[model samples]
Target: MRVWISGGGGFVGSNIVRAAVDGGHDVLTTAHTFVPPPDAAYAVSKVDMTNGADVRASIDSFDPDLVVHCAIMNDWDRMYADRQASWNAYVNATRHTAQAAIEGVDASYVLVSTDWVFDGTQGGADELTPPNPINLYGTLKLASEMVALEAGGAVARVSGVNGQHLARPSTPRAQDRGFGYFVASIVDSLSANEPFTVWEADDINMVATPSLALECGEIMLAIGEKHGTGVFHCCGADAVTRRDLAELTCDVFDLDADLLDFGPPDPASMLAAPVPYDTSLTTPRTDRILGRTATPVRTLIERFREQYAAQVGEPS
Candidate 1:
């Protein structure tokens, strides 16, 4: 299969690129600013998603059998600070991709979505759950998903994705970037015996990046193969509080649990957005269609530890 991915240099899309390559598919990837390190295995191109002509030209040129749209302007702080840029990245870019899929080729299109599309009132939200996004990012993603559906595409909504990647820098940032980065940074800090904080009230069902990518790739491939489109939720089987996740990371890494402090989440934090308290997703559709089961949190954390060790050249 010929597969093309947008934002393939990013944290999530990079994982999808690796997964697709491992699955023996011909892969093409696009990067806006951060060009991924060159790999002989897949083709890379620079694409500005905000430009309809750029997106259309790229997709039309690739003419892929499957196109997984994972691009986004995902920095929470920047999304709020520069709302127009965020809109262009998420809403306008998605519209361009959808049009390319609809007008250009018979490619199976898959739009990566988030559990943030929900408003947090319903825990374990399913494919049938209506999206009521509470924040600008979520709202734009939902709108993108609508564009995808109109273009005869499927939406794969995933939870917080965590795993180590070669693209991630060794130094920890002052603010949390995303769940995966947050977990890795916490482990790195705890390993250095540095104090770290976790919110007791914040909750999410975190999925391993490779897991989400594998399932999402297979689901997207199946969608292309069958010429079908709909929504699929691929998330962890269980939800955990930030506190519990931190404690579990400590346990898995044999770090000092004493250095971890628990606290309430501050909405004013740099990582702040309209995060749902409990956006755990149920994946009956994924199970029925892809024969996938929800991965356990412990299992995912263990995978994370192994990957981290590999990336850092340390013992697991």
Candidate 2:
């Protein structure tokens, strides 16, 4: 199958590119400022998704069987700080990409959304749950979802997505620094025998069913291949706290847990937007659609360990 993925230089999008190539699909991807390393398996084109003409031209040229839109302003703080840019990236980009996919090639479109669309008060929210986003990020994603759905496309809502940095393994982009990157940072600090401080707060301690980017990529591919439309929750089976995830990373990487200093988040550094306390999603429908259970957190961490080991040329 021919697949076109946007934001190929991003954290989840880069993994999607790798997943598509590994699945033996012809892949064409778009990158903005951060161009990923050139690989013989697939092609990468520098295209700005926020620009309708540029997005349309790229999709028209690729004429793919599937189009997965993953480009967006993913940072919560940044989204709150720069609302217009986020709007352009999320809503405008989705509009342009979905229209191009539908009109240009009639390709199967899948918009990569977030579990943040749900308010944190309700855990295990399903596809049937009416979304009431509390922050700008969620609001924008919800709007983007509407655009994709209106275009008769699928929405794959993933939560707390993290994995190895495929774009620049050595040094990830600022937007790419997520839970997985935090784990890597812990590993680096522990390897140097330096103390690493972890901020613990009511807002930041929200529970989430973390999803591995690689697995999410595969799920997105399956949704596109099946031409499934509607919302699908693609995330881990186990919902956990940030502290639990941090300890698990220490366990999986064989790092000293004592060096992790738990502290309160600095008031100055706290996010401006309201954060959901627990936005974990239920995936029974998604599981049925993919014919597989969502992976647990431990297993996801173990896979991350393998990727980290391979990247660092160390024995796992």
Candidate maximizing lDDT: 2
> What residue pairs are clashing in model 2?
none
Clashes of each: 0, 0
Residue 148 deviation, candidate 1, in Å?
A: 0.8
Candidate 1 on 110-140: residue-level lDDT in tens?
8888888887777778888898987787798
Give a tens-digit lDDT track for model 2, residues 1-316: 8999998878788899989999999999887888556545788888988889999988999899999999877677677778888999899999999999987899999999988888788888887799999878789999999999998999999888777768765664221212335666677777778877776666753578888888899999999888888989988898887678778888988888998887776576566667777888889888888788888889988997888787775422
Worst 10 residues of 2 by lDDT: 172-181
Q: lDDT of all predictions, in order shown?
A: 0.72, 0.82
Clashes of 2: 0
Give stretches of model 2 more than 4 Å off.
38-40, 74-78, 172-180
